[model samples]
Target chain A: MRILEYIALMAVPAVVLFAGVVMLFGGKNYFESFIKGAKEGFATAVGLLPTLVALLAAISMLRASGAIEFISSVLKEPLSALGIPSEIIPLLLTRPFSGSASSALFSDLIGNIGPDSFASLCAAVIMGSSDTVVYIISIYFSSVNIKKTRYAFPLAFVVMLFCIFFSCFICRIWFK
Target chain B: MLGKIFGIICIVSVFFGIACGNTGQLGSAVIDGASSAVTLTLALLGMMCLWSGILNVLKEAGAIKKLTVLMTPILKFFFPDAYKSGVGSEEIAANVAANLLGVGNAATPLALSAMKKLQLQNPTPEIASRDMITLAVLNTSSVSLIPSTVITLLRSSGSENPFDIIIPIWITSFTCAAMALILCRALGSATRVRTIRSKDYKSLKTQARQ
Candidate 1:
């Protein structure tokens, strides 16, 4: 953990320094290149705005309507039977769909249970290891204007489930 | 598939909430969701531009090329089709590099760029190719060496050992990424086989007619 923390703290600075030194010796016009890329980024963000609005609204609706909570409650028993802590089920359900919602659920979990508990640890690990699959898939695909995401959706969902279960399992052993 | 799911979820949520007499919350949720999306995008926009600028500088300096060279062996295993095609490999490498470096903001822009490049090589423009799916799955599985956000949240919440879960996260992230890659490869190959068989069947029928 000490070494990991050190690496995390230093990674950004190290990479930036390395890039700067390389650019200096490489004789590239750094500012021009940066501006060009920044323009591309601006386009990407603007292009994604519509999709973000739609996706986030739907996810929030699911949450606001109590659907996510309802779904999590129904799955709580079976998930707990499979060794998932019932307390973490809400985060698990929400994490794959929306980042903000999951983070909210995560803090709620940590706040309710305290940070050092097994469930909170699991939540942290889960949140760290996985991502908002639907969001990533939609944004990435839509950014490229690819409407037919054939198998990406199903494959991503499958992996999301795997990550959730695996994160809990690893946390159980590692934190224990 | 995703659009359908989103539509269904939205419709069901609206109806369910109204039926359950939570119409006020549902209305607010829709407004909040859209508003938050705007806020999130605004926040992400600057970071995306900043990181994109830096990454482009790195690319111009050939730093990313060197990193891609170093990553080839591992990337080859994960992105076989992209490597073989010799297209979008650079963006893929850059995207993966950003992801490994734990720069989420940079990763998204790089990933979107990579997806665009991959689309160039896509035979079917409307449909995603296998490599595109692989990239998305890879991102979804999240191979971040340091999950800085989670750590920040944990630290802010006053955890005694905030970094304690790093090892577990590293393990789980790697496992999930590997599993996702393998699953995509397996599924991709299965679909390929079916497509090939269909092509053969069509060719056979044409030969018979001739």
Candidate 2:
């Protein structure tokens, strides 16, 4: 099983390299395209600066203001009553909009709690199945100048709730 | 500013609630939690800026375009409306790719760009067309495969098997994606029918002229 997992991991890179090689053989212009692609990728990285700053600042404020903890406590009972672990609340809450922040929180969780624990598993699943709703909706809709997105926010919240609940439910069945 | 105001109100409310409830520990917990959150959030912002900047560079260099080409077929199936306008398709693909890679920080700008392009193609700004809504749904319910940050957190927390959650993660993500897709389709069809009916009513007078 471990070997299979290793193979799976290796496969992604192997395929990427193979494609790169194939492109190289396709024509001399392949190099130009590759360079151009890389350059564009770099530009995309730069273009994300302001949003990152805002997200970071917001996250900081939320944390500093005790808003996250407050929300966490508010959510604790319902989540725990549902058989969801308390430790995962932070990761689950943050995962949707700020990937990096969520990852950091995930790391902190794993560090504070044992990784093989139920809390860790639940956090991982929640992160995988959900997205950052507010960030995506605000940025996407605002960019397009769409003033009304009646369905987007509600749908995002529903999806996140479903993901958390479903992941917890399934994990209980599979792991236990 | 609004967020700050809301935060303060929340804090004050919590403090009073704790005092009234005679939960002494609650106050301390809130303080500690808030301070830690602020610190962590600051760190996260720095990381986001750095990462986003790099992603921006990638976009400028055309890597995003290359990625769009790579993911074109899937995007076409998922976002047929976007494909009608070359720009929409490209931007949508880029945004989706960024999300998939666990780069929400990078995905925001791309999503914005895609929305802009999508808006141009869709003149009726009042209503979100079928394709637009579908894309919105998919974007909102992005399926994350690795949950890299979560795994790292688990490992840090002294978990013996951080990646053990992979199977469960995959199961949940696939399920959510399937369900979201179905719901979006159903809602889209219903909305389309309503829009058509409205159009028919508006053209009722013209039908007599014809």
Candidate 3:
């Protein structure tokens, strides 16, 4: 299983390289297109800067103030019973509604706690696996003028529940 | 909603930091976080530039169109009405392929067009048809082949091998997507029966249109 993960790790770069090679051989004006796309990517990255900074500052202050530890201890009993590390409680609570905010929390965790730590690893998986249900629904539905979502929110919420539980369960075993 | 949480968290943390007599460290942590965010942004800029550039090359090579063609069978199975609606299937396929590559910024417009096309074919224009709902659900839970954002974060944070989480992330995301579809299909039968038995959904849809 670990070996498979190792291959998966390597495959990301391998696949990207292969894609580039294929395109280079099979396409036209490749350099111009690449430069254009690179510029757009850089611009988008620049746009994410402020939101990331503000949210991470708040999260870091909270962590240093021992607010997270305090809250974790308060919920420690119940969370441990479910095999959830208390450190990730913040992530679970915040992730469903707002994506960037949760990601801010995630980066904070990886920075404060080493990335290989159990809590950090689990946070990474949970953040990666889950969707920002409320955010996406609000944006997509409103764009299309979908006022009555009927079962959309409820069903998506159910999937989120599964995501939280299963991601915790799997991370515990995968990285344990 | 996020603003409220942010305000609440900051106020609570700073107040507690003062009480804990760690105000100085808390201030420093905030600064560190800011610096860290800059570092992360720089790293992300590099990765996104490379991937988006490669994606541009692939797009130019018509690989994405080929991918759309490859996606037709599954797209058809999920939303046959799209194929029937002339251009709807194409838009849906483009949206899904972009999503698979984790280019969500590129997928939204494609989705809006697909949704519009699907809407055009709706017998009852006010209510969302099953195909529209499926397309929306699939788009939201879209299975990403490479989670570039998460990877960039991990790499910036100094993980020995940032991409080790790839397999796990892939499995979990794909499972969620599969579960989403299964739930949609199962409820579809239930929804059909409910539509005839109750006017609540119909009224709701009419209200939305109004």
Candidate 4:
């Protein structure tokens, strides 16, 4: 199973590269177009620099200050009353805002709890299933300089909660 | 909006760290986090440049047009405003294709391009159109044929079967997207059922300029 996963990982880039070569043969101004696109990409990365700094700094501060841990513990009791495990709360909260942070936390959870455990599996599901909502909204909306996001922010968050609920609920049923 | 939220969170965290007697740790974390953000941005730059370059080859060859044709109907339904803008749908098609592959980095450039195109048609230049909101919804709750990142993490953790979560993630992705779409349709002013025609959009574009 792991072998197949590794193969798929290796294959995506290969396929893309192959397609890229095909395009070079079939297209006009290949190198010029690539440079043009690369220039655009470079600009985008530079443009997102400020937004990334702010979001990551805030996240790091919260993580370091123990606020996330504090909040998770506080939410645990109330969540348990509703049949949700407190162990997965941090992962749920972190999953939507930053991918690297969530990935770190997820690997940590699997290490502490054991991989075969239901909690670990649930963590995997939630992490895989949701995008970093706040990051996406902040970067994309700000990139186009659209100050009025209208329903985008609230709608993304609402969808995020639903992903968490369904990830845990379905994990419970499937792993049980 | 996010700036304000991040501000409140950071200030609260600063006070909380002081209260928790971890002022030194918090200070270091902030610096470390800021540096890592730069590192991540650098990493993004590499991937973005590579994919954008490669995809540009395909794009210049007009290969994306085939995908655009295939995706036109579905994209047209979800992004009516984008379709009205004509060229915006091309970007939308590329964005959606990258998204379904679970390559968020690859998708970001396309998504941003699509957003800019959609913004051009927006009645209010500063506000997102219906299509913009839907694109965000789609990107956030995107379906993936292979969630390579998640699987890699689980592998590092020594999961007996990391791939086991595939079906569950698929189910979760579908539901998240479905619910997001329904919510956007129900709660968004975008869904007031006001179909903004291209003629009206053009006139509004002029008005917006004025």
Model 1 lDDT per residue over A66-145, tens place: 66666668887898877677778767756777766666557556755888998899889889888899888998898888
Q: Candidate 2, which CAPRI tier?
A: acceptable
Whole-model lDDT for model 1 versus the true structure? 0.76
Q: Which candidate is the best by DockQ?
A: 3
Task: Name the lDDT value of residue A52 in candidate 1.
Answer: 67
Q: What is the alpha-carbon lDDT for the whole of candidate 3? A: 0.78
Better of 2 and 3 by lDDT: 3
Candidate 4 DockQ, CA atoms: 0.42
The runs of at least 3 residues in candidate 1 whose Cα sits more than 4 Å from the true structure, single-residue gaps closed, are A1-74, A145-147, B1-66, B196-210
In order of listing, the candidates' clash counts read: 0, 50, 0, 0
For all candidates, state DockQ relative to the true structure. Answer: 0.48, 0.25, 0.61, 0.42
lDDT of each: 0.76, 0.61, 0.78, 0.71
Q: Can you write out model 3's per-residue Cα lDDT over A1-176, one digit (the tens) per residue? A: 86887687777777678766865686466777788877888888898899888887888788889888888999999988887888888888888778888888887778778888888877877777777887776776677676666677777888877877777788877776
Among all candidates shown, the one with the greatest lDDT: 3
> What DockQ class does candidate 4 belong to?
acceptable
- In model 4, the clashing pairs are none
Each model's RMSD to truth, in Å? Answer: 5.9, 6.5, 3.3, 6.9
Q: Score candidate 2 by lDDT.
A: 0.61
Native contacts retained, all candidates in order? 0.77, 0.31, 0.63, 0.66
What local lDDT score does residue A116 receive in model 3, on the 0 to 100 scale? Answer: 85
Candidate number with the higher TM-score (2 or 3):
3
